[model samples]
Target: MKSQRFLKFYQSESEKYHGLRYGGLYGKLFKTLHHEALSGFLVQADNSEPILEIACGTGHTTGLLVKEGFDVIACDLTPGMMQRVSEQTGDQHEKVSFVRMDAFKLPFPDACVSTVVSTRFLHLFPADEQELIITEMYRVLKPGGVVLVDFDSWVHRWCWALPFALYNLLRYQRLAPYSIYNRIGRTITMASRVGFSDIKVDGIGGAQLLLPALISGSTALKVGRMHRRSVLRLIADQFMVCGKKY
Candidate 1:
């Protein structure tokens, strides 16, 4: 279930969320890097069974999965977001379904899903809650099933730390770490505890490190295009961790 805090935020933001997400060059860059990472996992997944996408905000990734020929259950905690997803995807694909649910308590049977994909959602909670969500995702995976989830990282925190701190202070009257090294480190440990093996972590959005130089629209597009390069992906601002249940 979506926390009251996040639920309220998304409810208010849903109307403009799609525009804000795709309107700017930075947003496009982030989306490109994110989809690249997601596609890499989906292509390797066993698509014989349905896949579950938790926190499927606006169905951007869900649409991709449907196009990839996987039956997808796209779930989110907010009805506003789910509605937007329906608007975006329409009724064109019969392989897709939308549901409202909590990430920590997914309503699925054990070992039932072939692949689980979540993006841009896990960083919302603290460490303990994140572990609970991870355990739940692991619980629903069939043997040999693959789980792909994204995490915010402190790898390039120095670049935007001050600005984010100021923004949070103005918005919430509190300073909080938006990205942290321990978040990803502890997530890997939690996945191990959940009995997920063959774990692999890949860095993404390294092009974000070039944000300082993106003064013009052209520069931003150039930097965004660099996201596909191998070396830049190694020092990314976020990461996607893939684990297989044995």
Candidate 2:
């Protein structure tokens, strides 16, 4: 039932999400947050290897990963999203391939990928389906392969208290049929049950206080500084969980 709901949501919103400016802004913001959250883990990664991005929307994160020299297989259930990815890639990305595949039943052979990464997509899954997807991630990864999952952590207001509250309220208006503030520890526990090791969380996307003030430059600097400090993890809006399959 939950999987069916997700499929419907993806099919309905895929085009709107990949084409609009607000969606694009959200996409870039998500990538920035993920880049901050995963910097430590990704830096430790062997860049010469290939990685799989489950539920990659419009290939935003895939583009960043590719820029860092990691080959990427970007997968999503949304055909339109995959089309947008292909448009962005434009026949030049030897390091990236976009595919349409279900996370619950990954099409890859077992132990085939060096890393499996996801961003902003887990909360879309109901509890059981989330577990199933985690299991699939584990099944597809080689021993010692890293898995990085990122999602909204409900504690987002901890950093920039005022702005986060306002932004979230506004977001609530936009991201209909979804609340976004799901349990982080429960998700972590699910990963543990799926046989993941070395589980740890990273903070992504601190507070954007000056958005109303129109201080883009200062806000960008603050975002970067907060990321460097890993300050948001102390009270992160999103949690980036890193673990190993073995």
Alpha-carbon RMSD, each predicted model: 3.2, 3.8
Model 2 off-target regions past 4 Å? Answer: 1-4, 19-30, 87-91, 157-176, 206-213, 227-231
Provide the lDDT at 62 for model 2: 74
Scored against the true structure, residue 229 in model 1 reaches a CA lDDT of: 42
User: Pairing residues by index, what is the TM-score of model 1?
Assistant: 0.84
Which pairs clash inside model 1? 1-102
Give residue 158's lDDT in candidate 2 (0 to 100).
44
Colliding pairs, model 2 = none
Error of 1 at 13 (Å): 1.5
lDDT of 2 by residue, 1-246 (tens): 655666777677777765552244444554555665676788756677888999888766676677677888899887767666654555547778778887888999999988999977887766776778888999998897999887666666444556655765785454233535546677678889999988887666544423412456446546644643365455545677889876
Q: Which stretches of candidate 1 lie over 4 Å from their true place?
A: 87-91, 167-183, 206-234
The best candidate by TM-score is 1
Candidate 2, backbone clash total:
0
The positional error of residue 174 in candidate 2, measured at the CA in angstroms, is 8.6
